[model samples]
Target: MKKENNTNKKAVCIMSGGMDSTLSAYMMKNQGYEVIAVHFNYDQRTQAKELACFENICESLHVKQKYILDLDFFKQLGASALTDTNIEVPTGGVEEGVPVTYVPFRNGIFLSMAAAIAEKEGAEVISIGVVEEDSSGYPDCREEYIQAMQKAINLGTKDDTKIEIKMPLVHLKKSQIVQEALHLDVPLELTWSCYKNEDKACGVCDSCRLRLNGFKKAGVNDPIPYA
Candidate 1:
């Protein structure tokens, strides 16, 4: 959707309705970019809840432009516990090595699609919230991978089209995320970080544990209820 007369610098933000992503989008908006939110529903276990949170978070952020892409192909190509029902979601404490919940090349796919959207929207930047220290061992969350993806994206696009991939929360710990979100007045309550059991968030899941621990470490109450 092209506006007849628009002069604002634009940013395509990949928001997952989680604290980190919400904070990242807020940071983009604070930097004077007209924020365009992009959310993906890849048939994850908590897809419905995540979608609901995404809507609410977008509304709270006053985001006028939003895209919800359904990558149903991810479900069909499922191998991870998040996309495949056969692989059980681990509930024990965070384990070493790559987590079973890691979606295969999910970020690569997302950034590729986002690059196309950025090219169309004339956006200069694409922002995603990927935490390293606080997350389970997910290979795709590393900054090096994102940096390489950014280089590839710029290289593959037209010479005139330059898009910067921004990961505002990449190096931050979960507690730092919580603190920053509070400072930015982000609607953290509307965010969902649970990997499974979306009705009230399975608090034992890796994602939930990280979120909860962040809030606890920040010495703040998590407004969202947990099961």
Candidate 2:
């Protein structure tokens, strides 16, 4: 991890109230960086609940700042289960074609917004918590996609100075990410990864299933309640 200059350096982390993203923010903060967390509100079925969790986590960690951007525009485009409540979030990761839960170009849009915010905030880096292991078939989460986005940011941003896209968990498996979060003393209980908005995690959606498996592989009992 490249250390930013301690004086007047700012970073904006794309936080989604999930284990990987929460851990990414914690790690950045630990490195003495001024961290700002950004969450997108896409009017998904679980948006409100996830925002609550995102706010709680950021407050608990005392992040320098947090931004919640409304993404209703993307919802209007509607091709994903996340944005379209009519479609069900897929269970397990064995389905054909990209999972129904794969939001259409979500990371691309989110990163573009984050880059603009970074320029305004005078941030040198924009960190996102995307892990290849968990992504499996998600094109947006791949290293190639991230690299392309970085190139675009450099070309498009006003600062002439390149904005680095940091992906600490890029190569690590979800289990490894969980272990790292635990080591960093991140509050896993504050994060939310369920596709359902019920009292407990549905435990079958792609996100929920992956999270549970990661905890099991890491030999750590997940702190969150599940259905």
The lDDT values for all models are 0.90, 0.85
> What does candidate 2's lDDT look like per residue over 82-124, in tens digits?
8888887777565776777778888999999999899888888
Candidate 1: misplaced stretches above 4 Å? 1-7
**Global Cα lDDT for candidate 1:** 0.90
Give the range where candidate 1 is weakest over 10 consecutive residues by summed lDDT.
Answer: 1-10
Instruction: TM-score each candidate.
Output: 0.95, 0.94
Error of 2 at 98 (Å): 1.1
Count steric clashes of candidate 2. Answer: 0
Q: Show model 2 residue runs off by greater than 4 Å.
A: 1-5
Worst 10 residues of 2 by lDDT: 1-10
Best by lDDT: 1
* Best candidate (score: TM-score): 1
